[model samples]
Target chain A: QKEVEQDPGPLSVPEGAIVSLNCTYSNSAFQYFMWYRQYSRKGPELLMYTYSSGNKEDGRFTAQVDKSSKYISLFIRDSQPSDSATYLCATGSNAGNNRKLIWGLGTSLAVNP
Target chain B: GAGVSQSPRYKVAKRGQDVALRCDPISGHVSLFWYQQALGQGPEFLTYFQNEAQLDKSGLPSDRFFAERPEGSVSTLKIQRTQQEDSAVYLCASSFRRGAPYNEQFFGPGTRLTVL
Candidate 1:
């Protein structure tokens, strides 16, 4: 099984709707979870980052992590057309030789105006 | 401040040919990383460098893939005898400090490679 699993969603929603993107990781050793936004033909940019469990909020975006279940999520409020992009989840471990991030298949989102 | 910059924004190579991609990381950043992203897929780790030292390269797909950071600033990824499967966007990222997993990596626009 892949270390990280995310649904490749071409999810479309109207503007002002709430959007939730999630991923599940198999490695319990993962201590850091991150969300990245990638536009077409562009490299990904860091959107949100969280360590261990709980939630971190940044403006309209909130990142939640549940270490017990190895599940992570990014919630976007009042989604806008500009928010249309692919959201990727990545997990990383601080242990030996495991510094590289394990990424999941990104979820594609399109917020129509 | 400029983010990471990669040269040859786009490249096309015939199968069996060699191609070299360059990355100019954020100045003074101690960590550099290379990732490959296929169409409709997320970026996959390729290799990482801390200064001039390559701390982890286990992610490299094969011997044909090689990356170097001789001066600790600019880095290069060389693919020898590229195959059709090598076609993908090569991304370069850098962070201000070492132990990259804990830091946020700023990425370049990336080099889109097409191996025919």
Candidate 2:
């Protein structure tokens, strides 16, 4: 099985709607979960990061991790056209040599105004 | 550079040609990383450096892929005899801490490499 799996979603939603993106993993050792947003022609910008299992909120974005189910999610409130981009999920067990990052295929999201 | 910086923003190379991508990390950052992102995929870890010491390079796909941080601040990833399969965006990232739990990697505007 792929270490991390995410549906590359070209998901479209009306502006102001709530959006949820998700990913699942097989590795039980991942202690850190992160969400990144990427625009075409740009590097991914870190949106939110969560350690262990819980929810971390940053303004319009919320990241939640369920270690029990090996699943993680990112929720966007009041989504906007500017929020249209690809969302990627990544996880790692350590830093430095532990810098190994398992990634899923990013989900493409379009918030139409 | 104030933020992590990458050069050439875009590069197109003929297959079998060599290519070098550069990155300037945030000043004094202790850790540097290289990642490869194929279309529609998340960035995959390629290698990492702690200051001038390379700690892990196992993520490199093959011998043609090499990265170095000579002065412990700036880094470069070189692809020798690049192949069409090597076409992807090469991203560089840096973090402030030396160890565990502080690995929040601040990224550069990656260099998109296309091998034709």
Q: After superposition, how far is residue A3 of candidate 2 from its true place, in Å?
A: 1.0
Reference-based lDDT, each prediction: 0.92, 0.90
TM-score of chain B of each: 0.96, 0.97
Deviation of model 2 at A23, angstroms: 0.6
Candidate 2: pairs in clash: none
lDDT of 2 by residue, A1-113 (tens): 78999999789999999999999999898889888888988878888889878888889898999999999999999999999999989898873368767788999999999
lDDT of 2 by residue, B1-116 (tens): 39999998999999999999999999989999999998878888899899998899988999999999999999999999999999999999998877768358888989999999
**TM-score of model 2's chain A:** 0.96
- lDDT, candidate 1, B1-116, per-residue tens: 78899989999999999999999999999889999999998889999898999989988999999999999999999999999999999999998856555768889999999999
TM-score of each: 0.97, 0.96
TM-score of chain A of each: 0.97, 0.96
Query: For each model in turn, which proportion of the native inter-chain contacts is also found?
Result: 0.70, 0.68
